[model samples]
Target: MRALVLAGGAGTRLRPITSTSAKQLVPVANKPILFYGLEQIRDAGVTEVGIIVGDTAADIEAAVGDGSALGISVTYLRQEAPLGLAHAVLTAADFLGDEDFVMFLGDNLIEGGIGDLVASFERDRPAAQLLLKQVPDPERFGVAVLADDGTIERLVEKPADPPSDLALVGVYLFTSAIVDAARRISPSARGELEITDAIQQLLDDGQTVRASRVEGWWLDTGKKDELLDANRIVLGTVTQRIDGDVDQDSTVTGAVVVEAGAVVTGSVLRGPAVIGADARIVDSYVGPFTSIAEGCVVTRSEVEFSVLMQGCVLTDVPRIEASLLGREVRVSRGARRPAAHRLLLGDHSDVELAEGS
Candidate 1:
């Protein structure tokens, strides 16, 4: 089966960062989230891949190149707008042709890969196979109702009252029959072609649609919390490989990976953390679940459980935890003499300040 990876959405939920970069290109453990999906597709023996690109097409293209780096040949398919999932499928119809394909959301992360899922599809294929996971907030996802025979009966896109806890995972396997279903379906109230509606059309056409529960973690890194959580989970699997310079005064512990050219002096790096290439950490504590991207700097500061993009500078910043910072940001301790609140905040932003500061 061919692979159709949709990387063409406006990630408005991850603003400031998404304002400058593509969400799929965001690094989880120093590797782009899109690369993870591509690696898994390669492992599944899919050689021909089509990537759907939107406004961030240039960034995605630059990062992924010709897909030779991922052991697959890629064809860039442009989407005029961020319509919807089924819309993306329609856009890729020419590339998909008559072959069965796997539709992977570029920003989704599924732990342990989809090797077995592809194997199952190759053995006994269905008209459409959806990956399902039990989520607490099914109302926020595409809800699926299953028949007694473990087949999909109905699907709803973000219903106010969900029928079941089973939510559709971002990865879907579909046959060429889905192309007809997508074409037959109408756009939902959201003004976009809903994949759930397309799948329901398959059911209406007397086609067999199946659901398979995900055995491992599945993450849709749409917002800040989800992004950081995915980062933490991915970092847990990273093996220790220190290719950088760490002074004798520095203490690097646990599963930390310091990439080449990175320097750590008089710093304490905790486990499951990575200091990217050319990054510098001096007299700082780089705690767990944190990724300091390439060329970032941290001096006399402490950070934990955060993802710092490339070229960020943190000097005497005291302590920052559970945060996501964009590239080229500089956070420094303000002058004590000023004793004023100088702020430029975004919409719905929350800030806390010490008394008398």
Candidate 2:
């Protein structure tokens, strides 16, 4: 079996950040999200993989190359536009050939690897297997309805009123039969060929479709809040090791990873945080769930639960949390603006003054 990783979405939800960098490349624990997906795929014993890329194809190609370093040979499939998930599969048809494949979304984070899922697919050889997880907002994701016997009866994409809380996770296992399903399905109401629609087509044709409730943590790192959450989840599992320079005057706590070339002096680094390579933190507090990317500088700044990209600098900033700082971002003290309230009064109305009223 091969793997087809979708790296094509525009990631509009990430806004200005996605405008410059691919969402899949966004870092959590100082590692790209796409890299984690690739690692998981490699761990599943898949040797050949195809990555479907869109506008950010060049960057993705440069990062993965031949995938030799990751123990896999990568073939790049270019999708001119993100027609939909099904469209991505259609684009990778040539690379996927007639073998069973696993499709993983680059922006999705799954705590447990897909190794077991791949093994199960190989054993059962189902036409398609969908991973399901209970989510609070089922309306925001593709949802599945289970029959009385616990089989997937139907799959719906972002239904306004969902039949179940079991939302479809981003990982999918499919056999060669899906190629025909992709060709047979029509575009959804949104004008894109959704993967859920194809699965619905399979269900309509009485094909075997299975669903598994995910048992571990899962996150879609498409927004600032989710990105921060993903960072905390992954960083919490990393072992504590201070490999870089930590000054004698500094105090380091649990699960802190100080990469080579980084210098921490007279500062306190809390647990489950990472200081990237060449980063400098001085006289500040690096709190929990923070990731300071390579070459960043934090001086006299107390930051917590924040992500600083390469070359960012923060001085005297305090209580920073759940922020996504782009490269070259510089945070410093600013002059206080005068506090005043302006009101547009009606022609015949009198505005009350604070002193009198």
Candidate 3:
């Protein structure tokens, strides 16, 4: 089977960060979110992959290239706009071409991979198979209603009164029939062709629609808090590997990873945390669930549960927690006559300042 990965959405929810960089490229555990999906698709034994790209097409292409590095041959399909999930599938029709395939959202992180889901789909050959997870806020997602035999009976996209708690996970398996289903559906009230409508079309046409419960975590990294949560979860799985230099004045504990060329001096690194290549940590405390990307510098600062992207510099910043810093962001203590907070925040940037520190 082949794979159709959607990396095209303009992540408005992530704002400032997504304004400059693709949301799919956001790092979780110092790895791009999209990379995890690609790796899972590869692990599921599907090498022929088509990636859907939109405004951030160039960035996605630069990071993924031909996908040969990940042992998959990638074909880039450009979508004219950020239409919808069904629209993405329609855009990939040429590459998908009458073959069964899996559609995965690039910014989502699903635990345990999609190997078993692929195996099941290949065996059942359902018209469409969706991965569902029980979520408290079903209204926030495309929800499904199941029959007595566990087959998917009805699907709704962001219903005000959801029929069930089974929210659609980002991973989906489909036969070629879905192409027609997508074409048969009209755009929703939101002016986008909803995938739920396409799948509902299959059910209306007497085609089998199946669902598998997600037994593990499923994270959609579209917002700040959600991204941070994903980072924390992924960091929990890291194993200690000190490939970089940890000076005699430094102390490392727990599952910390110091990548080659990174230097830690007079600091405390408490894992599960990762200090990326060429990053320097001096006279600071790098706490758990944190990922400091390559070429970043942290001196006389204390950062915990935060994600700092490449080339960030944090100097004399007393504390930072549960934060996401974009590339080359500099946070330093200023020596001024009067103490006050200074910020040059971007659009939709959220910051909570501690008063009188």
> In angstroms, how far off is 306's CA in candidate 1?
0.2
* Model 2: pairs clashing at backbone N, Cα or C within 3 Å: none
| Residue range with the least summed lDDT across 10 consecutive positions in model 1 | 348-357
Sort every candidate by lDDT, greatest first. Answer: 3, 1, 2
Q: Rate the local accuracy (lDDT) of all candidates.
A: 0.92, 0.88, 0.96
The runs of at least 3 residues in candidate 1 whose Cα sits more than 4 Å from the true structure, single-residue gaps closed, are 344-357
Q: Model 3 scores what on Cα lDDT?
A: 0.96
Best candidate, lDDT-wise?
Answer: 3
lDDT of 3 by residue, 168-213 (tens): 9999999999999999999999999899999999999999999999
lDDT of 1 at 105: 95
lDDT of 2: 0.88
TM-score preference between candidates 1 and 2, better one: 1
Could you tell me how far off, in angstroms, the CA of residue 220 lies in candidate 2 after the best superposition? 0.8
lDDT of 1 by residue, 13-77 (tens): 88867887898988888888899999999998998999999999999999989999789999999
Per-model tally of clashing residue pairs: 0, 0, 0
Off by over 4 Å in 3: none
> Which is the leading candidate under TM-score?
3
The weakest ten consecutive residues by lDDT in model 2 span 343-352
